[model samples]
Target: MANLLDQLKSYTTVVSDTGDINSIKKYKPTDATTNPSLIAAAAQMPEYQSIVDDCLLAARKQLGTAATDEQVAAAAFKSLAVAFGKKILEIVPGRVSTEVDARLSFDTEGTLAAARDIIAQYNAAGITNDHVLVKVASTWEGIKAAEILEKEGIHCNLTLLFGLHQAIACAEAKVTLISPFVGRILDWYKKDTGKDYHGAEDPGVESVTEIFYYYKHFGYKTQVMGASFRNTGEITELAGCDLLTIAPKLLEELQTTEGTLPLKLDASKAAAMNIDKIPMDKATFDAMHEKNRMAKDKLQEGIDGFSKALVDLEALLAKRVAELNVAV
Candidate 1:
């Protein structure tokens, strides 16, 4: 019998949900995703230090001698994610999701600018946009920005998505992918209801399943990638999703566990269900956002968390650059 990992892969495209290259290599996921938090964690590793150092030096040179260390650190922040994405692309045979600054979640122009810069950097490195998925928060503004980017041949991954409205908007915009977070949804429900959820009953699992059914029912082309899993059970429950971005530890569990992983989410099954389609314009999106407490709170909280991680990474870059200068 095949292990769960291999069995799961036959049903869904597995994506590594960390910036650690070694973990990605061990699991061999089809794709990899990195957010500010993951990139910050990987920056501390000795093997990845050189990637950070190179970004700092390049930022310094680009800005010239008039630039202060603080300015260089700020400048290097964007490239750090791309640098990590570039490295991840070398390992994964599929796309690598490099996030736009989460601070730009509500700023359409700012998100577009950051996303363009990220893609430009990858292009300069000879990595085509096909191998890169610029990740943006699934705010109304973010979705609109991605809509524009998509027409220009840039693919996007709408993330921090907690509700169906966000998913529908992303699909309507024709973005390449939407990352509906599974574990985070469960986190919110578990805390709010003060109860435990397991197996197919997990709220996170249900959320993705709903979105999957909606998409398949409407015949929307935007792919759904179930992300941010808390356990292997959550992972198994999402089998046959378009994709699942899993952390390394859970990937290890699936790799070692032997079982018949039956397909839990099938497009054919979703298409046959009686799912209602929600119109997802900015007004509708806003109305839904205001109505869904879990989506609103979790979206804001996820942005704040990622922004903090970016701030910490910038501070680390500044300190490392200072030490490098002293050594010279």
Candidate 2:
């Protein structure tokens, strides 16, 4: 039997969710995704150190000696995103989703500016939107920003998504794709109930399945890309999704398995479901978000974690700048 990766490809597009090039080369996912946390982790790796150094050098050249720590850090991040995207593109024949600063989750203007900067960097490096998807948080502001970006021919991948409201919002905005987080939902439920979920009944799996069905049922053009997977079980459960972004570890785990992978989601079947499509306005979206305690808490937590990681990355870049100054 072929590897699980190959099997999954038959049903859904497999995306590598890492900033590590070696992992992408190993699993050869059809697409790839990167965030601040993943890029920070990759920066610490010896193999990726050169990319950091290059970024630092570029920052110094552009910002000059008087650039503030925050400016230097931002430049380094943009450089790292571009570098990782270039390397990943060499291995994967499909698109890569590079995220904006999580700190800009609620700031539509800031998110748009950062997104434009990221895309500009990619374009300078000769990568087009055809192979790039700017990843943004699925907040109301972020979704609206994505709507504008999509019109400009720059596709988006809405990440940190949880509830049906978020999905509906993304579809309404006409985002190119939405990554409903599967593993994080599982984590939330496990922590809330203090029990391990098993098999197909997992909350994460259920969440993505429901979102996938709704998108298909309503003829929403927004692609459902399941992400933040915790295990192969959750991934396999969402096999027939538009796309699934898997971490390096999970991708490796899937590559080792060689058995029958069953199909769990079908768009045609989903379209046949007896469900009415509901439009989500500001008032409705707010009410739904307030009702879903899980979504509310998880969204805040995700934002906080990403913000903290961004701070840590900035500190690392500051240290690098200090060292570079001493050398100069």
Candidate 3:
């Protein structure tokens, strides 16, 4: 009998949700994703030290010897993500998701500039936009920026999404992908309601299921990738999603477990179901965002978390530059 991982991959494209290149190789996901936190985590690994040093050296070279450690770190922070994406792209057959700095989540212009800069780095490395999905938070500004990037032939993956409104907005924007966090949503519900969820009953699983149905039913081209899973149950429950970016641990569990992974979500059934469509724009997005407390809180929290991780990475690089006494 084939393992669950192989079965799941048969119906849904499995994406690795970490920056660890070895894990990507081990699990062999079609696509891989990385955010500031994952990149920071990977940067600390001894195996990845050379990658970090090279990015810092390149940044220092660009800025000249007069650049402070702080300046060098900031520049390297921008390059580090694309650097990791480049490595992951070497392994994954499909596109790799490299995120914009989370601090720019609310700044559409900053996000746009950062995304363009990331894409430019990849381009310089001989990787085109087709091989990458510039990931951004699902803020209205982020979605708007992605909408423009899409028009320019650059693809985007809108992350930290928790509400139907955000999903609708991304679909309307025609962004290439949307990563609805399944585990985080479950965490919020478990904390707020004080009830343990099981399998299909899991709030996180239900959330992504609704999103998968909504996207297929509405004929949205934007792909839904269920991400940040907490358990194998949530994973198996969302068996037939368009994609599911899973953690290495869960991937390992699925790889060893033998079971028939059923196709839980079907596009044809979703298309036939009666699901109301909401008109999405800046105003509607804002209103719906304001109304959905879970989405608003989680979006802000996810941004803050990712922003802090970026800050920590910058500091680590700064310290490295100082320790090495890097000059020119």
Candidate No. with top lDDT: 1
On residues 253-272, what C-alpha lDDT tens digit does candidate 1 reach at each position? 99999989999997887656
Residue 327, candidate 2: Cα error in Å is 3.4
Q: After superposition, how far is residue 318 of candidate 1 from its true place, in Å?
A: 1.0
Model 3, residue 157: displacement in angstroms? 0.2
Cα deviation of 298, candidate 2, in Å: 0.5
TM-score of each: 0.98, 0.96, 0.98
Ranked by lDDT, the better of candidates 1 and 2 is: 1
Expressed as tens digits, the lDDT of each residue in 53-80 for candidate 2 is: 8888888789986887678877786677
**Model 3 spans > 4 angstroms off:** 326-328
Give the range where candidate 3 is weakest over 10 consecutive residues by summed lDDT.
319-328
Q: Write the per-residue lDDT of candidate 3 for residues 227-282, one digit (tens) a residue.
A: 99989999999888999999999999999999788989888898679988888878
Per-candidate Cα lDDT values, in order, are 0.93, 0.88, 0.92
Ranking by lDDT: 1, 3, 2
lDDT of 3: 0.92
